[model samples]
Target: MLTIEDCIALSGLNEAEIEAISEHEHIPEIVAVEYGNYLMHSPDGVPMLKRIILDDIAAAEQRNDLKHALHLRLVLRHFIRTHRDLHKVAN
Candidate 1:
């Protein structure tokens, strides 16, 4: 059977991204992994994932959690890099 780590690896999203989606959508991490995997393929999906990361960053800042905010920023950068193609069409 596949483990959570396997699922996470397959989803191509890091734990931070998945956790943010779970918190934002109030869903389980596993479900978030499935969603992430699905979104990785759909054109609208990456944008939605970007929105989730942005929301997470805002929440972290609101809570005065600078460390987490910084981490989420890194995640956002990586997400942007990984999905650079998706953004190119907009430019």
Candidate 2:
């Protein structure tokens, strides 16, 4: 059986991005790995993933967790930089 870390490694997403999906979807990290992987391959899923990360950042700020909020912002920045579709959306 594969460990959660193995699943994450094969999911083509970093731990932070997977955690954001888990937070936004109310799913476990392992489940998030599969779900996020599915989303990465779907045309609509990329934008949805971006929105989910943004929502997580907002939630972190709402709870006054500045450190976590900042971390998520960095993850979001990295996410945007890596996803070409997002750049098109931004332009």
Candidate 3:
């Protein structure tokens, strides 16, 4: 039985990124983990996750949660730096 943490670790997404995906897709974190795992292997899914994180940052700002918003921004920055090739097309 893989725990949620294990699933998340395997997906290569941080908690904030996974949470963004969950909220955007209106699914639970555990389900998002499975989806994330799939997405991590797909070219389209990388950009999709980026969009989800942007949406989450916007939502946080709308609620006046600057701290959370800033944190999420940092997470996005790190994700982008680490997964730069994920967004590129072979052709």
Candidate 4:
């Protein structure tokens, strides 16, 4: 059987990006992997993913977890950089 790691590997997103989607959507990692894949292909998906990551960053900042907030920023950057074709979604 394929493990969660295997599933994550099949998706375009990295583990951190999958985790952020899980956290934002309140889903498990495996589910997030599938959801993230779906989002990456749809037209409006990039902005939605951006919103999710931004929300995560805001939540981390709200709790004073600057480290996590910074990490999420990196994740956001990578996400944007990875989905270059969809980058014109106009944040």
Candidate 5:
């Protein structure tokens, strides 16, 4: 059985992205790992994660939480740089 840490390490997603997904989707960290794995493997996963990050950033903005919004934005930017598909989307 794959541990959450194992999955996270293999998924190539940052901790912030995983934490944001887990919190936004109300899922456990392990589940978030599985979701991250799926997204990492799927062709459309990068776009989906991008959309989720945008939503999280929007929510943070709505709450006037500049720190959280900036953090999420940074995560998204990092994801785009690290993942080729997402980099394409960023361009």
Candidate 6:
């Protein structure tokens, strides 16, 4: 079985990204790890992950959680850099 750390390492997703996913989706870290792995591997998951992160950022903004919002934006930017082709077109 894949550990959360292993999945996280393989998924190319940062800690903040995973945490945001967990918080926004009300999922546990281990489940978030699996979801992150699925997102990294699936053909259509990257953009979906991006959208999720963007939504999280917006939610953070609404709550005035500037730190979290900035962190999510950074995560999304890194995701874009690593998976440039995945986000070729803007949503």
Encode model 5's per-residue lDDT on 1-91: one tens digit a residue: 9776777898888788898888789899888878988987777788888888899999999999999999999988888778875657544
lDDT score of model 6? 0.81
Q: What lDDT tens digits, residue by residue, belong to model 6 across residues 4-91?
A: 6787888778777788778768999878877887877787778788888899999999999999899888888888897786667533
- Pairs of colliding residues, candidate 3: none
On residues 1-91, what C-alpha lDDT tens digit does candidate 1 reach at each position? 9998899999988887888889888999999999999987776787888888999899999999999999889989988897788756533
- Compare candidates 1 and 2 on TM-score and give the better one: 2
Compose the digit string of candidate 3's lDDT tens values, residues 1-91: 9888888999998787888788878999999998988988886888877887899899999999999899889978987877877755511
Clashing pairs in 4: none
**Is candidate 3 or 6 superior in lDDT?**
3
lDDT of each: 0.87, 0.89, 0.84, 0.91, 0.84, 0.81
Question: Any runs in candidate 3 off by more than 4 Å, and if so which?
Answer: none
RMSD to native, candidate 4: 1.5
Comparing 1 with 6 on TM-score, the higher-scoring candidate is 1
Clashing residue pairs, candidate 5?
none
lDDT of 4 at 68: 96
The pairs that clash in candidate 1 are: none
After superposing candidate 2 on the true structure, give the runs of residues whose Cα lies further than 4 Å from its correct spot: 85-91
| C-alpha positional error of residue 42 in candidate 1 after TM-score superposition, expressed in Å | 1.7
lDDT digits (tens) for residues 1-91 of candidate 4: 9988888888878999999999999998889999998987787888999999999999999999999999999999998888877778645
Residue 25 of candidate 6: its Cα lDDT? 81
For candidate 1, the 10 contiguous residues with the lowest summed lDDT are 82-91
TM-score of each: 0.86, 0.87, 0.84, 0.89, 0.86, 0.82
